[model samples]
Target: MAQARCPLPSLLLVLVAVVLLVPRAAGYPWQVCGNTGSFTANSTYQANLALLAIALPKNISSSPDLFATTIVGAIPELVSALALCRGDANATTCSACLVTAFQDVQNVCSLDRSAAIYYDPCILYYSNDDSFLSSADNVASASTNRINLRNVTSDPARFNRLVGALVNATAEYAAYNSTRRYASGEADFDQEYPKVYSWAQCTPDLTPAQCRVCLAGIIAEMPRLFTDRVGGRVLGIRCSYRYEVFSFLNSPVMVQLAAESGNSGSPTPAMGPTSVTPSAAGGGEY
Candidate 1:
């Protein structure tokens, strides 16, 4: 008996499946505050913003802090701009991320006097007001993982506790231990399932205590903000935290650190097809 083959329809279906499976690059999310304030073309504020956009990336790349803040012109027309790259990012990555952010901000928030762009590798914020320089604004913008935590454990509550401990410890290490104010590591809950890899970072200008506070605030919000998610992040002007079941850091050092800490288990082999993409779910202005 010969089996009849439906090759054409089957091929089309396979192609459709492949397209759906591929992950698209979402880049980052940004906010432009037109009602809060705005600037017109050819205005002094606009000119200052243009200059700040060009200078911020360069300053960040050259500085040891991997953070840069500048005020162009006087207070009224002054444009207070800052660029903070993720602590683990290399200078090249920081520069490119800032460059993309600069262009993206202009496109997304064109003519707005106040705006901020949040990328996975960096953040760019500029405004007519300088208050953000010293203030810690936790609610400005944020996102979380698109996928939920695979229910690998019998006790989801216990999983949450272990994740919290790893994230909190990473925050402390970022705040007090690293010169770059960043830390990444992993923790093993079940030897057979994926180990949770996490990282936290703060802008170096913040005092250790301040950095801890910023990290803590976001960490506390995770359960409410992205419950049941295997990986997610909460970003703020002063600090941010991220964790995942995969190698989000994309660095071997994270694994080494976990091993040194005696949690040598690696992320569980992909049990199924899961997409670890970030989602721009909820974000609002300060």
Candidate 2:
């Protein structure tokens, strides 16, 4: 039989199409460009923002808490910025995430004087208004995987109850027990999906009460946002929580619990507490 071959141009075109059609593994970043105002190019506000982009990443990566806030310039040109890395993210990852975030926000928001950009590893926000640097009052955004849990369809109410218990406990641990204001835990469910993993975090600068309130605000939206989904996350400026059927967190689970037998409401903590020691500098936090 004669050998078959694709034309060079045709083969190249097909390859290009395939590459272009492939989805980004990390997914697209979520961003909000504030309507507060816009800054003109080459303005002092733009210059101050440029300085912030360089300073925040360095400050956050070096900080023990993996969080940093700064104000550059003075008066109307002041640019206040905050950057926070996920508790499990290493310094390198945190720095890189923020560096890219600054670039991404500038590109996505263009000349907007206030904007926030979020990624899996970190979040960056800068504004002419300094209140955002300390306030936890921002609205949260939810991201849910399209696939529903196969096991949950059989008993959605039970699944919902379990999810509520898992996230609430995780939030409590993050707010109260964790030094970094972050925690991850697992809950035992039915056999079909034996476990549900959850993670909760808040900006380390926030007080325990503030963290709890911030997390509570987002948790309240779960029924409307997550339901029986296999995975979902609510991301906010000050706090966030994520849940999945499969494990998506680092080791040393901070809390473990099992659903009570029969038609009980909440899960009970498993015996023996698990503690996480904070990692060394350049590594992740507890």
Candidate 3:
């Protein structure tokens, strides 16, 4: 049999919106073990990876940008690693999350020569190949809430249009308006579901045009993956987006839009049962 090759690490781009109240939990992480190659138990590559585990977290926590990339060891045995924490995360949280990620990748991916791991608060990726450090390819993964929007079943098209506008606007702000490449906003929808909240973010290292391209790739997937869902997210190594009916992000929403008028939309239905929190974390290997 021919040997199979693992695909390149997929970028996860998340766009989420929630309906019912879901309990929030940290949840399990999504990980990809690359097909590039492997390292021996005590090889020089292993030593370099170990050094990165300690150094990356410290560097990211200390930097105002909350992002860091490093190259360790000479070529052949070299390792390149990058880490990014969500914009709203505190320094303490960013540091702690990366420290845990470094330990977790080893357990989950073992001695793989390259790997990528995703969590709610952060992302960590390392490899013998450095091409990914600057590349913003469209490889992607997405997650959606289990519940549908309360009114979406009545008028899915309208709901989708609103979501597209909100997400696209947020993406523009994250790319052009925010130095950190992060943005959150809300738009008025209907009387029953009065507001929709959304967020967008990209790794700070990407240029504005690169950031826009990264986010647009994921947004194009929204109609297929998240049309009527109350909450969904697409996560990419380079960029990500999320939306919810209820507010899930921090204070000071970055952008706001008024509800569109003139549409005699369908009658608002009774609210769904509350108290169910959407799953906070989910992903799949590409």
Identify the leading candidate in terms of lDDT: 2
RMSD of each: 11.9, 8.6, 12.8
Evaluate model 2: give its lDDT: 0.76
Q: What is the lDDT of residue 2 in candidate 2?
A: 96
Off by over 4 Å in 2: 1-27, 139-151, 264-285
Ten contiguous residues with the weakest lDDT in model 1: 277-286
Q: What are the per-residue Cα lDDT tens digits for candidate 2 across 179-280? A: 799988787787777888888899988898888888887787777677767678877778888888888765567767676355644322221223333222
Give the count of colliding residue pairs in each prediction.
Answer: 2, 0, 30
Candidate with the greatest TM-score versus the true structure: 2
* TM-score for predicted model 3 compared with the true structure: 0.76
Model 1: per-residue lDDT, tens digit, 254-286?
322231233323232212211221212311110
Q: What TM-score would each prediction reach against the true structure?
A: 0.73, 0.79, 0.76
Q: Judged by lDDT relative to the true structure, which candidate is superior, 2 or 3?
A: 2
TM-score of 1: 0.73
